[model samples]
Every structure is written in C-alpha cells, then in structure tokens.
Target: MDLSCSDQSDHPSRRRALAVATGLAAGALLPPAAATPSAAAPATGPAGAAAASYTNPVIWQDFADLDVIRVGDTYYASASTMHYSPGAPVLRSYDLVNWEIAGHSVPVLDFGAKYDLNGARGYVRGIWASSLAYRPSNRTFYWLGQIDFARTYIYTATAVEGPWNRLTTLSTPYYDAGLLVDTDDTLYVAYGNTTIHVAQLSPDGRTQVRTQQVFTTPSSVGTLEGSRFYKINGQYYIFLTRPANGQYILKSSSGPFGPYTMRQVLLDLPGPIPGGGVPHQGGLVRTQNGAWYYLAFVDAYPGGRVPALAPVSWTSDGWPVVQLVNGAWGTSYPSPAVPPPPRQVTPMTGVDTFDGTTLSPRWEWNHNPDNTKWSAGNGLTLRTATVTDDLYGARNTLTHRIQGPTSTATVQLDHSAMRDGDRAGLALLRDSSAWIGLKRDGGVTRVVMVSGLTMDGNWNTTGTGTDLASAPVSGSRIWLRANADIRPGGPRPGRFSYSTDGITFTRLGPDFSLGNDWRFFMGYRFALFNHATRALGGAVRVTRFELSTP
Candidate 1:
C-alpha cells in the first residue's frame, strides 16, 4: 500500500510548495469559461438544451481511494473506508459528476475479533485499498480489498447496492489489488507496492491458479501502488500511482501478465487545496457517447483524500492522457454529453433525523459496532460499555465525514438515561480526537470539553487526554456542535461549542487543531459516542444530527 504522507517530517515544506502551486493553477485556470459552480444548482437540461455542467471534485466530501466503472449509462464508484465499517462504500451516478451512496459491499467488517473490538485493534489494518468491477459474463459485481496481514477477501453481489456474499478469502495477500475480468470471462488480479504482480484467478474467482511477475517500478519512482487493470481495444493497461510522478499507465499488448510498457498519464497535477499533495489512485471510465474520463483523488488531510474528475483523450497510438488546463490539472470541465436522469443528485453530507429504524447510509461505525449495545426507536440509543478510556477503544462510535472549506455538525443528545460515570457527547474523531459533551459524575451532569492527542507512533489509540473546559448543566438534554474551517489558511481548527436551548450556542475550549494522523489515514469525522469510564449500564439518546456547509 502507498502510505499517506500526512505525518512525514518533510510535510511542512512539501505542503507549503503544494499550496503555492495550487493557488497559481486555480487562479490561472478557473475563469468564467471554467466556473466552479455550486453543488446545489440543479443539473438539468431542457428537451434539447446544453448538458448540465459541473466543476471538479464531482463529489465534494471525502470519497477517497476511488475505482469507477460504467455499466450502460449508469456509473458506479467504490472507495476505501479503512477501518470504518460498512467498509467499501459504493456510489452510483447517472452523470459522472453527481453521485450518491448507492450502498456498501459489507454491512460490517467481521474479519476477526479485533474488528469486533475484542482484544486487538484494527485501526489502520482493515480494508486498506479496494477495487470494484462488474462482470458482464454473470451480470455480477465483484469487490476486492486487502486486509493487511490477513488474506485478500473477495465479495460478490448481483446488484451494485448489495446483498453481497463474501465468496471467499485468498491466502495470498494481493496488496492494493485490482480485479479485471477479461472478455473471455477470465479473471485476473494485478497488485503490489514496489514490485507489481499479475495472477490468474479460478473460474469461480476464488483461488489463484497461476502467478507471474509483470513489472516492477523503478527505484526512482518513490512509491508505486493503487493498480487498476483494464483491457481497452485489445490492449492491457494497468494504472498505477507514484507519489513523486503522479499517476501512470502500463500498457501491454502481449497479455494480462505482461512485459508491459509504462507512461505517465497524469503528471504533476496540482493538488485540490493549498498544502495538499497531487491527485492519484483512481480509475478511468467511458461514457455512452464514447468519451473517456479519469477519476482520481488528492491527498487532502484533516478531511481525507477527496475525488477529482478529469477528461481523458486517447492518442492515435492508443494511450490515454488526462486533459490539463494551463499545463496543470483542470478544476472545472464540461459535463459528459450523456443526458442526466430526472433523479436528484444528493450530496454525501446531510442531516440524520435518527427517526428511521436503521442508521443512515451516511453514518459509519468506528469499527464493527456491538449491535446489541445500540438501538433505534424514537431516537438513537447507545448503551455505555466498559471499553478503554480512549474513544478509539469505545465501540458504537457513529461517525460522518467532515466537509471541506467549512462545515458545521450539531447533534441533540438526551443524557437523561445516562448513569454515573457515563460520558455522552459529540466528538471530532481522527487519529487525534476532541469532544464536547455531558459527563455524569457524583449525581451531577456537567458540560465537559475533552481533547485527546495521539503521539507519532501511538496512532492505533489516543495517547493522552486533557480536560479543556467544563460547566454545570441543569438539564439532561443538550446540544453539541463542531464548526470546522478547513479552507486554505494556517492550521485547520475545529471550534467546539455547546447549547442548552439548541438555538444559542456557546463556544468551548481553545481552537482544536485537526491533525492528520497517518495511523487513521483519514480526515476528521464528526463522531457520536457514549462510553463509561467507571461502570456500564449508561445510555444516551441522540434525537437529531444536522450538518451544514458554506
């Protein structure tokens, strides 16, 4: 796997350079002709009006490690969720630009006891990188993910939004694997980090029949991973990313397991934000109109890696090139010619009423949640458990991704059911976490603000916590909100605030700096947690969660 550069020692210098470059590019490329339109604007075309156009980052929220496939006129994308379960999120789009969460490949990542919050931890372990493919032979969808130390798992579903079956797990680890089902119905897997390998899978796509060394990236290529295998026009192409050189494509006319030739398809593309890295680790897809486009992600920290869309053109020699504006990555492009359907294009971020029987698809558990410890009736009820003192160990910590530029998340919590030693509140969860919530102590409930920072090596859990602020609360029901300003500036700080009436909010604690801890390998997320520091049998009822951005 290509580990993120969030915590690297040279991150400061690299980030400064990236920021300058990105600003210049955006100023130069983005104009009236290439406008970055609002996502709320309807993407519609009258009977024969111009196709609706959209800006880059088709999906604004953190939809990282992207792999996209177009079947007929519909487009489906699958991304890496790391340890966040309901892991492998699959998003569907009528227009390649607008997408909504169709479903997830698995409801819970139940690979081992660690994933279930037993003895060990799966913080940076579960579901590293994933590949999603649709096989025309059986009309089945296949999803593959690397479980780090464990085997590579294969999941299949008849429908994209599944009822997926975990068909089998292979003993051999296919690091950052890419699945390709050929025209002849032969299954192939291409994977590796420094050294790339190709193998033939069984007809059932379960076992590896044969393996061969295809190509190894030169030592000069800093880190090469995230492989997307394709057979276009009878030629085999494998898309891989090198941190220093951006994304490259390996071409082979010989076979799937090839002595391939490589070319840099996307090179030195400007990062989406200032202080961000280049965009990479995504696949390509074609529209019904015979146009091609590449979908990739930029390493935007404190908000996770977000996806970017770019138009693609094939040269006369049969190589695909990402279109660049002003000699850099383009931020806005014309929408595909395909007419978008009448369906509404929903943003990934929205309010969760907690009125439904099941959690919204927008919400994901910190790990595989303890199902028995949670329920949804009139609201979301989370029973306190004796996990570790840290929020990392506490299960049933429901989280949603924080949006970019600026966003705010507010949740109304009913702590009346909470017992002594019960702490229930809203948290900004990442490798480092902070929360403002109600803590019941000595028969008194107080509004307390706590912040935890993880040291360099101790990313699996919170290193230490400090009490930032506290105040006495007379009522059991309280509202907690986090305002995040992640736009290009100095440090991206999240302001924590509390409210009793839900209309007026009072700020709590100092500005909380959102750190990009490499262990979590994700952006800061809004988390709802209820845990017991002393004893169990405590509970919190969350009635509403509202998210807003501007």
Candidate 2:
C-alpha cells in the first residue's frame, strides 16, 4: 500500500559494514566485543504510496523467499521463482513498499535437462530460498542458491538489472543459505536445514574454503532453515525460520563460528492480512540511515507467497526484534525513505505491449525454454514448443506474477495461425490449473473454457482439462480474460471471460476455485500458452497483456 543515518559508535556492525566496503584490518577475523551489545539507530520512514505509512504484503504479488539488501539509497531484493525460467527475480525499490522488477539474477534455470521440462520433471524444484549479496569492494551483486539440493549455483553481475553471468557452481550445496560479505571482504555462507552450517568461501566468493556445523536444532525446534547471516552489535547472528513454528535468532559472541545461544523471537502471527497464513522465511536489511527491517513472506494462498515488511528494534541486550502492534504483526508500518514521485521503472502491475525484441523482465517462461520456438518482435509469437496432451508438458508457456485481493488478466490473442489439434489460451495456473481460449480441431475453431485440470503427486498432468464449455467462434482475433479473487481464504474464485470485439464480454464455464494445497508451494499465476495436442509448427500471437486490479 505504502513505503535512515549510520551510527558507527551505535553498532559495531556499522563500522564492520564500512570495513566490509573498504576492507577491515587484515589480521582481525572478528570485531571486538563489548560488555553490552552494540547499538543501532531507530527507524524513520514513510509508506510506498503518498499515504506516509506503508501497508503490509507491500508488493502484493508472489515475490517469495526474499533476500534483500541496500546499496546506497536503493534496496534490491532477490526472490525464488521455483521452476520458472529466469529463476531468481530481482526487485528494486527506492521506497521498499513500491517495488519494481529490476531484472533477474538467473537468466535461465539450466541446472539440469529436467529444468527444461524435457522429461516433465523439475516441478516444485530448481531454485529455492536464494541468498543475494553485494560486495562494495568490487561493486558487484552475487546470487547463490541450492538447486535440486545437489549443488549451489552462483551468479555475479555489476548491476541489479543484470547482464548476469554464472560465476561458478559449488559441488557442495548450501541449503537456504545466507550469503554474507564480512568486514575483511571475506565471504561466508551460513546455511543448512535442522543442523546449521557456516561455510567460508574463497576471497572472490566463488569457491568454498571449508564448512563446519555451527549450531544444531534443539528438541523444541523441530526444523529450521532460511538462514540470514549478519554481524550486528559485534555479534555474529543467524536469523532462522522454523516455518509455522516461529522466527528464531542465534547469537554468537565468540565469532562467526560459535558457541551460540538461540531464542524464538515471535510466533503465531495475526498476520498482515486476514487468513494470509503465516509470514516467514525472509532476510533483513539496514537502511543507509542505519534503521533495521525484516522483509518476510506470507503464504497468501491462491495469490501465492507475498512479501510483508516489518520494522525491527534492537533490544538493549543487542537483539533485533520484529516490532508488533496490538500484540500482532501490524498491517501498516513506516516505509523506508525515498525520493519524490515518478519512479524510474514501471511498477509491478501494468500493460505490456509485446513489441520488444526480448520479453520484459517481468515475464518468465514456465521452465527453461526452447528459445528457438518463441519471439517477441510483433506481439509474442509462441510457435508450439511441445506437442503434448496437457499444458504441464508444454514448454515456453509464458507467465507473469498475478496480483492480490482481486485482479484480472486480459490479453489480445491472434489465433489465425493455429493448426489442427492446437490449443492456445490464457490460464490461471498452479498444481491445479484452468484456462479459456481457442481449440482448433479439423478445420473448425471453437472458443473453449476448460477446468478441473490437475497435476499428479509427482507434478505430471495426467491429462488435459475437462471441457466445461465451448462456443463456435469466428475470426482470428479474440480477447481472453481471467478474473481472480485471491484473498487468502475460501472461495478463492478464478473465472474466465472472452470477447470478440474487445468490448462486450461473455463469462465462460463454472468458477474454477483456486486451491490452497500446500504440496504445490508456488501459488496461482497468469499464463499465456500454445501447445500442440498432435504435432508442432502451429503458432499464436499475443498482442498485449493488461494486468489490472479492482
């Protein structure tokens, strides 16, 4: 809805941060300890909008598993897209509440052939809970994530909107890792599941030096991950999430490798939104002014996991706590500072004309694509990349993050090029999906609405959707629309509509209720796809996509 100074004497981490930027004293691996915890400045902010107070789930779309940082006055956040191509989405904001799609740290999820959807595998896999870091000495941004739980992939770029290059892949996986560039310009990765491990990396941060278990979960904490490492108040801290359990912090006064003590800071949230589930597993950031904040995710099902920002206050004991309002997570908080109106980039929701040489960074393929099969020159031309029974096996199915509460996706489609046995449409997707579009059979074309489609336990679409409704339609140009009420509870309604002249519309089919199944982690999406039920070479063009909210 809406949207700091440094104190070196206030917190040693501030001095260590400067050292991390300029390089610290070579010999000291750690900052000196104080009898009391180091201090940090209190927060100062306004919301992302003109309201002067920011709303929770700030960028209310599925920007999940975030790791955020501040570079100068701007904040950069990298998030997981799971099996989506361009795996890690990088979001930028002058004011944290009003974020923009900066670019992607990962150009493609090429960790394996399966990621290409070559074998109908890689669903609910690929990138997860990535760690994003910035090294001031080299002025580069780093993205690291465990892929398939087999290897950790690292990427580097000079800018947030990258021409990102894969630096290297470490054979050792760092699960839910937190990438930290320390005082001496040293790199360390704090990661793991229940048993946490801190790994030291090479000077450039590409290679692993060594890894050792730093902390083990207690019996009270069943499982723990999403480790975000920080040096604050001269203490090495690892902030962790026990998912539905609560948020916890591990403080090590000794050093990065520690004899550490743990504490559960908050639990059982009356989340930012009603029925928005729990907000968990995110990273923390310190504004240029030295104020601290935590950006976490709310499993707002049907809409997916959306980001929620909350302020952090340091306890006199040096611990950072998520400030609560009325004994619950507040719905609105003071936003970080920003320059006046008119942002340089487009906001998250808007109209996209498919006239660019490449698709906008906001669009991502369902998986690693067959790049040869698609182009964006004169509207999106998706030449059937896969000939399959269902959309799940279809490659190059383009998608955009669907918005929250309620939203509509409208697209102008040119379907004249569709050949026999071709299906081209607009869809609301997740484990269970639905769509409305054109299906060509023989020499006849029909406007069709399909629903009750679902994927198997292993993510394979057993078959195409049931035909809920169909009408004979003429002409090549048609407008397809989908409306969703993704407000985190029952009757998460998803519906389809169509128009012949882009004015008068007819609702189609029964409402396809968006499901809240936890097995399929990622939430509903707005999708554009064309696939062959028989053979390939058939294509369709999408002239424009307008994403709107009401």
Candidate 3:
C-alpha cells in the first residue's frame, strides 16, 4: 500500500527487538542464545551439514517483489528482476535445496520491438512479482503479471509450462498483486498498501466474478504491499513485506477481511555483514517434510545478490521464528533433505579462466547475441563489427558473472592493430548508464564514465573525461573494487576504484551512489566490445580474468 538506517556493531548485539504475534506465539522471547552456536557444530561447519539446519537463512538472491507457491510435486518461485535479461526467470526446485531456472513466464515484453528504443533487448522488463495459481477443478494453472505500475493481466494454460492463452487484463491496476484461493474455492486478489481486496474468479481461471472488499493493512508500515494468505488452523494469516522492515505476517480468525493481529517478526535484517547486509523478503516455503520455512534475499557484497533460503520453526504457540546460529543465519546452512542419492553438481566456486575454449554458463550477453561475433577459442577473441549506433544501445558486448564487489580482471588488448571503427575495452558495468570502462583509443587507454544511460540512449557522466592514464595502473591484474557502505540520513555511496597491477590502487576521484537503474541491469559482468564503424584488424585477447575480493 505505502512506502518508506544502519550501524556497524558486531555479531549478535546484546539487545533484542520483538514485535507481537497474537493468538500465535505470544510474548515468547526466543533470545539469541536460544539458538546459540555450540561446540557440536562449529560456527563454520562443513556447508550443508545436518547440524546447520537449525540456524541459518534458507534463500538468498535479489528476488525483489518475491512470491512463492507450491504446485503439484514442486515449489515454484518468481521474483522481479532488477536488471535480469531473458524475461522473468522462474526458478523450480523439488526440495527447495537444489534450484534450477526452469523457464520464463512471458516469452516477450517488446523491449526492442515495440519501443524502437536503442537497446531494446529483453533481458529483464515489466514483469514483477507474478503469482501462480492452480485451479484444480478445471485442471488449469493461472499466472498473473503486473506491469507499468499496476496494470495487471492474466495468462492461463493446462500446464505450468505453457502453450498458454491470454485470459483477461484487469481494469484495476495493483503494483504487486497476491492471489489466494479460499477453502470454498473463492479466489481473492490482494493489492499493495491499499485496502486488501478479494474477488471470486471464474472456474476457468479467466474472468472475475464481482467487485472486491477492502481490508485495511495494520498501521505499522505506511503502505502495505505484498499480501498473501495462509490458512493455519482456521486462522487467515496475511504475510506482508513491511516496506523498510523485513517480512511480517498478520492473523485473523474470520474470513479474508478481518480484524487481524500481528504476530512475531518472521524475518528481519540479520544484523549486518562486512560488505553488506542479510535480509529476507516476504516469501514462505512449506517443505515436503511438513516443516515450514521462509525464503528471502541476502546481499553478500559482490557475492550473494541472488535469493537465499532460511528455515523457520513454529513455537509452542502458533507463531513462526527464523533459526539463526550465534543468533543469525549465514550463507552455508544445512542442505535441505537430499532425495536419496541426490544428483550432485558441484557449485561453481572461483573465477573462471577464459582459456580460449569452452564458454562457461556464468558468461552471458545482454540479449540474443550473434554467436559468430565471438570466438571462444584462440584466447577469447571479440571482433568489433560495424556500429551505426553505440554498442551499448544494442546487445553486442560480452560480460561475465560478478564474483564480488571488490574484484579484478585483466584483458590484453591489441588496439594498436585494431581497425578505425573497431573499439575494445574492459567494463565495470552495473548497467549501460552507471558503469566505468577503460578503452584504448588513439593508442591510449582512456577511462570513460556514465552516471546512468537514458531511455533516449545518452550517457550522463560526472565529468568530461577522456583518459585514465593520470590514474594509477600498478600491475598486470587490472582490478575494479566496488565498496558497499550504508549511510544514515544521506545517500550511501558505492565507491569504485581500479588498479593496474592488482596491488597498488587509485581511487577514480569520486563515489557513485548505487542507483535503481542497475536494478534492471542486475549483477556486474565484464565485456569486450568492438563497436567501430570499420571492422578492427587485430583480435582482442582477454587473459587472467580473475576476480578477487579485496
């Protein structure tokens, strides 16, 4: 419905902050020591060890505007992309431990086509917190997507993976709508921060029955959004993300609209970490083991921007509380129940050496890229093609995974041999507009900057800079460090610095506050570009592309 500080203390501050949970776990204070770290399991235990289950966050990612649902035999979750390409990626998992990108909900949102905009690529677009519902009576699944600030539409199919049919577009626009199916088979649609509303949907999962009723959100968070329903023992629990605070749930004994009472802080900011913080979105997970847990996003500074999982235990009373060791959860938690002899695919650990062959999954382009433009063999060659427009507008560059905030990469450029129109460089990009890149033009490596790219295809820079030579370049391992800090009252600046030898470093003379523009762009990835009008002569070889956290 409506919208809305930080400190560096230590691990598990002595004090505790508690919100009420009525008729649920009432007045029960589960102190930090309740789930205290013990000698049984070391603070740093073998990741996913059995003992780790009792205390740790379960889901970690930038799954903003998160929505979780359980379909037949699987748990499906969809979140809004800050800057995700390829559309709204749906993650599927059998036990919530192992996750894989099953597919996208909408095949297209007309980024490059309808908009005629310069870089009209569909990496991540309008689709936000989409809700999935299965109408068992008709053997059908309903998917609702919100775009353009509350414009809502419904798509339905016989299966989750669709040959779907567009059902109807809602005249009422709600930002992030949550869908709930009542025990009587009545469908309730909830909007953000405003009066929580409900409506009955046609059995076919297409049309609506009548106008909706309004249930006011409790006056804790000014604008209440992200409202979902859960019927626990005849009580309707409305789980909502409380703007600035983490996820909280309210319970009522009556119908969808009721005089509900707030019960317990299911998940909140788990204190703070070195480069960033750990917090949860308003997402819940009920596992096959009859155990219920909460899934939220954790920012692990240069590492975890994606979603992470956390287990929640019910108190003797009906309330829920997140389990954390040393009073909080960390990244490596007990692995979820492995389905007897679980299929094991080792998680990718460190930097990938782009050794002339075999492109890694971590490597991705902004959009559908021409395969011929890049040569994986012969030392990662990227040829600059004709550029009628700046390469940033279109998807012609190459980028890799952002390991951490403070990481470094080195690419050998043979620009002296490069043709006139061709240009190649290493970029530290959050998006097209808020990025810093070093390119060799006219036989010199210059530092080019942009504050953020505009919809009209222009860049805003702090200053009119043409070169980076005045800055320090100490070694062969060129490094870019993104410092994450939180400030109160004022904007916390995310500082960017660079080093040539990977040892001695020099600040780029200014700090750039992390902007929302990158949310659409998402995580950091490096790219080699050749955007010259004429084809460049020599190929560019990117080597020692190692990322290290400073």
Candidate 4:
C-alpha cells in the first residue's frame, strides 16, 4: 500500500461547506450536482461537478460495530445486527466511498429459542460486535461473534453472498473479538473490555490453542474494547475502541500474543454530524492501489451509529494517523480509490415495490420471524404471527435502517384483511418508539398514532404506548408515513402522518421525540408491523415502501 504519510494531504478544501443531501442512502458520497435530497448530512468538501470526494459517514444508515476488508478490487463490510434476523448484512463497494447491500453473512439469527419471540424475548440481546475475515489461502470468508456473552459462534462461506454455515460453537465466549490471519496463515483473536487478551486459534481456526492476558487498561483511559487485529510491516497490531468516544492501538513486535505497547489513535474527535459522538469502533483497510483508510462508526443516535471513512497515513514513528483538518476530524475527504460506478448494487435505503417473490436482502425481521407466516409477491404480506398487546412481543415485523441526518419512509398498506383487535401499519422502531397504523377493534377500523412506548429493565413491553390520535376510517387501504430528524441534539422528534388517498396526508399528534440512549445500540429503524391482539389469522399487504431523505 502507499504506506507513507509524508505526502498524503490531510488538509481538505478550505470550502468545507455542507452540500445539499446527495440522494437517499446509497448516494451519500455522490457530488451534489448529480444528487437530490438525502438522509445523509451533505458532503462537506468541494462541490465541483467532476470532484471525486465524499462526506464522512459515507453510509447514512446505521451499520454499527462494522469491520471492513478488501479482497482483490472489491471491499466488503459486515456490521452488527442485534435482534434483527438475517442478521449480519454484507455490504460491497468498488470505491470505498459508496456501498450497497451484497448479501448477508447470517441468514437467520438462530442462536436460541428466545430469538423466535413466540413466548419469549430477545430484543437488544442477539448479535453484537463481530469480526469478519477473509482467508484467501482457503478461499473462504469467516464471520465470528459471541451472542449475549454466551458461547462464541463462527460461520464460514466461500462468498459474501453466501450459503453461510455454522462451522462451530466454542463453549467459551470472546466478547468484541477481532480476528487476524497472519502471513503464515495463523489465526488469532484479541478480545475483552477493561482488560484485553489475545488468543491463538488452532489450525482449523475453530479452537483456541493458547491464550494470554496481553494488556490492561490504566483506569485513566477507563475501558477499551471492539478489537480489530492486524499485521503490517512484520509488526502485530490490534485496533480497539473505547466506545462512543475513542480509538486506540496496541502494537506487539513479538507476536499476536503480545508484550505490546499502546497508543491512542483518535479520541472524542467530533463526528461529521454536529452534536454526534466520535468516530470509533470499526476496522481498517487498504485499497487495491495501496491507499490506507480507517472505517469507523459515529454514534448518531435516534438514527443509530453509522460508518464513516477517513484517509489513513503513517507517522515516521510507525503509528497510523487519521487525517484531520484544523485539528478536528474533517467532514469530507477525497475518494480513496477511483473505480467504475457501482454495479449489481442495491441501495441501502430506497423504494421496494414488493414485485418479486422474494424480499430484497436489505429487509430484516425484528427478530427471528415466523417465515411460514410472511410472503412477498404482488405486495409483501405479513400474517400476524402472535397475539399480543405489546409491539415488542409481536412477531414477523420486518425492518430496515432509516436514512440519517433526516429521512422519510412511506408505505401503502391494504388493511382489508385485518381482523378484530389487529394493529397494522408503519413504525419507527426503537426502545422508546412510536407508530401510525390502522387498528381494527369491535368491527370498527380506526387510524391511530401511538407514541412514548418504552421498554423496561428486562426489555419486556412496559406499556402499549400512548395513543396520540385516532379516527374511524372507511377505506380498506391507507398510506402511512414517518418523517425523522435523527440528527443528534436534544430530543429530535420523528413525526407521523397518514392518508386515505395517496395524494396528501394528515400530519397529526404531538411529535414523538427520538431517544438519546446509546445503550440500546441498534438506533432507530423504520419497520412494517402487523400483529393481532386477538387471533393470528389477520394480515396486512404492504404494496410499496419508499424511503426518502431531505
């Protein structure tokens, strides 16, 4: 790689004015001239028509605790998907700036029965931080992570779009683990928080052969986790995050198990979005042309944590430096590799008309959904999988990350099949959540808006949420919309609206203030749900799901 730092320009264009939104989610990095409104905060560097530059948080959707790797001319990223079935989403990119859904590493989150959400629950407790690695020697990709701090599970596939199969389940767990395959093809894992340890894996990359407690945090730095192990220039290094705050590096000239030295890579560097958290907790990669870059996530709550890309340069002292402008992390930087426009790429946020028999790979269930109860054809149909008054307890809710900074999602739903006590519509899914849907009760159908729903200590449904507004409706079909200002600050509210005809909508009820808690981690998402409080035979047909940003 062009490993030298002496010539790399950390200074971006002095004209770092935020441009208008690019175009929805995938167009986040495009120049404004070819763009429309987007959920992403605008690209902040030069807006020249031919300029090849991109803003930070290159992906405006939440793909938290991400790990990016490059193979040949292609780059792939796999991110955390707690409680979302079809969990580990694999994203592909030609140029590091723009990304699209390639497929998934985990087709179904089947770690336990609770994930089914039948009579149990698994919200905010499934897949957390994970490590994604490629083994060219074996022509395989391996995804490894611990579920709920239980046993560690490793999955392997020949391609990113996979028939990924479970390789093994280690009885022991490795939290926030980072995987490394040395030049000699030896496997290693660095894990733990507050204290760190390195483990060497057996030849097959399944069992732990040897382990060592390599380092301990000094308390002054508090804690460090989210590990990403790497070997460069004959030296062993481990990249870790102090979460929602900083990034650190541990260098071991010895081996993967180290007598290591430490250095701070970045700390509390302001994110591209104002009032957002720092860029940390992710991985690093080098473009085929040898440009090094760091792919980290910024905590942009309400919308969740999103990935940002920054150029990486090495110091004469042999440390990696994330380029900065005027002592702060810049909002935009030049595209690391100039490649042909994206191909066979599905936008992370866009319109899905449900024309095909199978749903797009971008859609994930709120949990391990009852696949037997849901189908997609003329429109996506979701049959009530469970009877529950609590939305969290309801099964078969399909969801996708919303666009960031700002975005809107609209869905056209045919609720004629909704039976008594059935609630079907669109929602902004989070811990403290809200929704606008058609509720059928006592032979009468009403359009209702519900808000202020919060989960309790055990994530059980504490309240059904407040009904902000309601009206008896005659139409069998209705349109629902959710407009969100997820940009960080105090109480950014996501509002709800509805329409009987598709032309206009009723913007009603008080604003549903977005949540600020980072512990929930997945952030807010736009979800389509239909559940019966009485029986399971009710269903809703979602004809269109259109996502837009402004």
- Report the number of the highest-lDDT candidate: 2
What is the number of residue pairs that collide in model 1?
A: 1
* Candidate 3, poorest ten consecutive residues by summed lDDT: 1-10
For every model in order, what is the number of clashing pairs?
1, 11, 54, 0
lDDT of 2 by residue, 151-270 (tens): 988899999888999999899978778877776677888887779899898997778999999999997777666787777656777877766436788888998889889988777777
lDDT per model vs. reference: 0.72, 0.76, 0.46, 0.75
Report the candidate with higher TM-score, 3 versus 4. Answer: 4
Off by over 4 Å in 4: 1-50, 341-344
Query: Tens digit of lDDT per residue, candidate 3, span 72-113?
Result: 446566555422333444556555555545555554453335
After TM-score superposition, what is the CA distance of residue 468 in candidate 1 from its true location, in Å? Answer: 1.3
Which portions of model 1 show Cα errors greater than 4 Å? Answer: 1-52, 455-462, 517-519
Q: TM-score of every model?
A: 0.90, 0.91, 0.64, 0.90
From the highest lDDT down, the ranking of the candidates is 2, 4, 1, 3
Tell me how far the alpha carbon of residue 17 in candidate 1 is from the true structure, in angstroms, after superposition. Answer: 14
- Per-residue CA lDDT of model 1 for 277-313, tens digit only, reads 6767777776555566677776667776677787777
Residue 286, model 3, lDDT: 54
Whole-model lDDT, model 4: 0.75
